[model samples]
Structures are given as C-alpha cells and as structure tokens.
Target: MDLDMAQVRAFVHAAQEMHFGRAAGDLGVTQQALSKRIGRLESLLGTKLFERLGHGVGLTEEGRRFLESARRALAASDDAVATIAGKDRPLRVDVWGHLYAPTRTLLQVAGRADELRLELGHGRDLPGAMTALLRGDIDVALGRIHPPLSPGLAHRLVRLEPVDAVLSTDHPLASEPTLRPEQLRDSVLWAPGALERLDFLRRFADRFGVRERSGSVNLGLAHFLTEVAVDPRRFSLVPADMPLPDIPGLRSVPLVDPTPLYAWSLLWRTGSTHPGLSTLAAACAGEAGRSRWLEYDPTRDWLPDLPTDRAEAHSG
Candidate 1:
C-alpha cells in the first residue's frame, strides 16, 4: 500500500495531542479532513489506530506501537527536507507566571543539553503562553498547566516544588519557623493576579479558609513580595527554593502539615518539529528524577486537582 505522509503526520500529532481537533489545527487542516486521513490510513493498514474519547481522543494499542514507527518515518523525512532546504534555526522557548524565577528551572534544562541554541522569551501567564504556543511564537514553554488549556497544546509535567509563605517578619506568624495552612486562614491571601485568573491560588485560599483576599499588580516578584512584607496581615506564597531579594523585614516560612506545591510543565504545540523539543523533555525528565522534581505525597502535600489526574483518567 502507498502510505500518505499526510495521514502518517496526522496520526502522530493526534496521538501526541490526544485530540483530533488539535492535531488538525497543527496540520492546518480541517478536523474532518484529519479524521478522513487517519481513517484511510487505518483502512489501508486493516487496523484501528485510535479510540474516541468523550473529551478528546486516545491511541489504541496498535496506535501506540504505530506511533514509534510513524515518528521515525517523519524524522527521516524531516531530516531530508531540512538537509535540502538548509533552514536550521534556534529553538525558541518561554516561561510564564511571575512568582517563581523561571531561570532557575531553565538553567537546569540548559545544563543537561549537550549542545544547545535557544531563543528565550517570557509570557504573562498560562493563557498568554498558550497563545504564543498556538501562534508558533515559541517551540516550548515552561509553567503551570492547569486547564482549561487550548486543545492545540500538549504538555508534560516536569516540576512540583513545595511552596512557602512570604510575609513581614513582624507578622505574628513569622515568629514560628514553620506554619500550617490553618494558621493563615485569618490572614489575607495576597496574589499577583485577579483570584479568578489565578485558579491554583484561589483554590488554595478557599480550601484553607483564607477569607480575605488581596491582589497586587505584578510589578515583578520583588515588588509584590515587598508589598507582602509591608502588610503584616497579607501573605503570598512562592516556590520554596526561589530566592527572594533581601527586602528588609521580609521573611519566608515553610508550611507544614500539608504543604502546597507549585506545578510546572513543559508545553508545546502538538505537532512541533523543533529539534530541541525532545532534548528539553529528556533534560526535564532527567532532572526531575535526579532532583525529585515531580515527587508528591498526598498525605503530606496539598495540590489542586491538576491536568495529570485528567491525563491518567484518559489513559484508563
């Protein structure tokens, strides 16, 4: 049978995205067209490649195995085209969310890559970053990936860091080296975005009975953190290891009992062809294993229901 590269490409993207619509968008084709291509491919192969999911799509066992060969085929084709065209370019990447120093995580990724050429940028938040990814502005993005993400994007969780509260050293709670969630219930939850936009922080505040919430314009982490230090009743959280500037009277304290963790994921367009995409994934996975970046204990940690849970559900 003559294989259609278009059909093979559709299958690979749909398998990666787990969504027919997303794969179609990446291919710049209508979803119906993408579906037809895959259907034709399946008919030719005499095997079903995908199983429809209620919310998206999934790979059948055959589809999963077929993906390995499909990728190799596409890689060879891409390499041949690249060789003829001489269109090599640096991989563009970005990070979103302001609370944590994205550089800390990005540096780790760069460190593990053998030979890397990158063009780095920043996104305002997840929604903003999602736009950049959809527009092809960046090859990959690093940030929290709480849904509702656009179907055009696919992601892999790479980091989960325990969070700590930042407040004035003068705050009554600051006297304690470690505080628990309940201790902050009476204090204001200071956040950089509208609570509606920062769902993770909103969920956290609601779960821990933090009634009074406050928002600050994200001038930057240092400025927002300084505001936290100025108001004894206001507190904000950051990834535990993110270094804070030496703002006088500001103190960072760990939360015990049930610590909340900030989740980070590497996101990309489902059909991205950047050579650095896999290198970044391998680096993130390797560092996660070495640093226990994705480790979590339900009994000891607090996290909002995340995309990983839904992904696991889709597979099941």
Candidate 2:
C-alpha cells in the first residue's frame, strides 16, 4: 500500500486552515489543485474527512481521528528524509503578535533563506504558541518569549524591535517629534486585554505611572489603531518598523528616553532533532546581523528582562 505524500500534505494543510482557499495559498497551489488533492486523499482513505461548511471546512470524526496520525506520519517521513534531504519537508512555524505584524521579522529572514521550506501559522500570542511547542504541534515559533518556558524548549533572541506610541492626531503630544514614556502618564493606556495580563503594557504602565486604562477587543493592528484614533486621551504601542495602515486622524510618535523594545525570539523543542532547526537559527542570525535587528541599548531602550540564552543554553 502506497500513499502519496503530496496528497497527504495537501489534506493536512486543508485541515489546519479549515479554508480551502487559504490552505491552497499556504501550499502555493491553486484552489482547484488543492481540492483535487483532497479528493484523491479521501478516495484513497475511503473516508470523508471534512464536511463542507457555510464559511470554512469542518473536520468530520474521521478527520479529527486522522489528524494525529497524519501529523505522526509526516513527522516520521520528515525524520527519514532529513537524513539525506532535509530541505524537502516543510518546517512548521508559528508566530504571534499579529497586531505588530510579526511576519515583518520572519518574512525578511525567510526571503533570504534558501535551505528551509516553511509552513507558517499565526499562534495568536506567546502563551498559545508555547503550548503548541510543548505539545510538539509545531517545529518552531517566533514571538516575544518571556521566562518560564516549559521543559524541553530552547530559545534564541532574534530581534529587538523598538515600539512607538500610537495616538490620535488631536492628542496634545501628537505634534511632538518624540515623546518620553512619562508623557503617556496623562493619557489612558488602551490595550486589548486586562492590564494585569498584558505583561509588557502592565510593566510599562507600572514603571511609567500610567494609572488609567481602557480598551476594546484584541483586534488586529488596523482596528486597534482606529480605536486609538477615536479618542485624543487614548494611546497604545506598536512596532516602529511595522507599516501602518492609512487610517484617518492617527499619529505614531516615537517614544524616546528609554524606548520600549519588543524582543522577538525563535523557540523550538530541545533534544528532538528537527533538521531545519539549525538552518532556521542560522538564517535568523544572518538576517539579524545584516539588519542589526538585535541592537539594544540599556540606556536608550527598555526590555522586560535581559536577553535569553540561545538555543540549547537554557530551558524552564
């Protein structure tokens, strides 16, 4: 009995995305091709794996059961192929902090890398991605890694991104070329979730004397910026390098005199040999050096904690 790995892989992506068009885009295949691949896979398995839904696809019982086995099969195949052709298998990577467009860091490195084949997903946040990492659901994740990572995980500090203060054009400080963190004390710290749970913002507010806070849902960057543009007293932070949407009546001002730095790290499980691990790390290192991404000055910049140890050096 022989199974086509391509068909299996197409099915896996379709299952993960639950949207045929998105799955096709992820696979770099046309939608028709992806649908055909899924059809072939279902025919070979003699089971219906997905139910057509009004919006996206839903996994049937068979698909839910087969997902685990499919992942294992891919892992086994990847491991076997790594001995000779590691680049052939796609390395699963997850990223978070979409509000800041984390892919700006990833795609820059990915554009320069030639050795790695990647499949990227948005894990939404650090905690979510960490859970997936511990469970072996992904090969790598890129995000802000705070301390207390689970055992068997390793991390490499990849980038130090300087964040800017986003405020309404009507804000009193908006006209200033650069504002200090202390200036935000007069304004409300708008955020997605509770201030206590938002580690970075909470710490920043605690240290900077921002006592007032309020915000809406944790929507994407545009929505958050739009919300900021609504009130002159509300402000938030965003990566300075990220491209901002052309929303009306919003201004992004740089926060100086110890600017907050969002540390982006590459995380993976230790002791499990994934061939692309070293390749991806090397690629990140290369891009970091070429782009000066890891530059952090204690006097001019701020981070919640000191730099994390590189791959295999430390784990929680």
* CA RMSD of all predictions: 8.9, 8.2
**Please, what are the lDDT tens digits per residue for candidate 2 over residues 91-187?**
8899987777788888899888877788989896777887676445788999887767765567888888889999999998989999999999989
lDDT of 2: 0.82
Give Cα-based local distance difference scores for all models.
0.82, 0.82
Which 10-residue span in candidate 1 carries the lowest summed lDDT?
Answer: 307-316
Angstrom error at residue 142, model 1:
0.7
In model 1, the clashing pairs are: none
Cα lDDT, model 1, residue 84: 52
- In the predicted model 2, the residue pairs found to clash are none
**Per-residue CA lDDT of candidate 1, range 1-316, in tens?**
7788888988888887899998899889999999999999999999999999899988999998888677667655654664456346767888887568776898887887867677888888888887666545577898888868876568887777789989998888998989998899999999997888887889999899999998978898888888888988999888888888989989999998998988788898776666778878888878877887777777788778755633321110
* Per-candidate TM-score against the hidden true structure: 0.71, 0.71
Using alpha carbons, what is the TM-score of model 2?
0.71
Runs in model 2 deviating more than 4 A are 1-87, 310-316
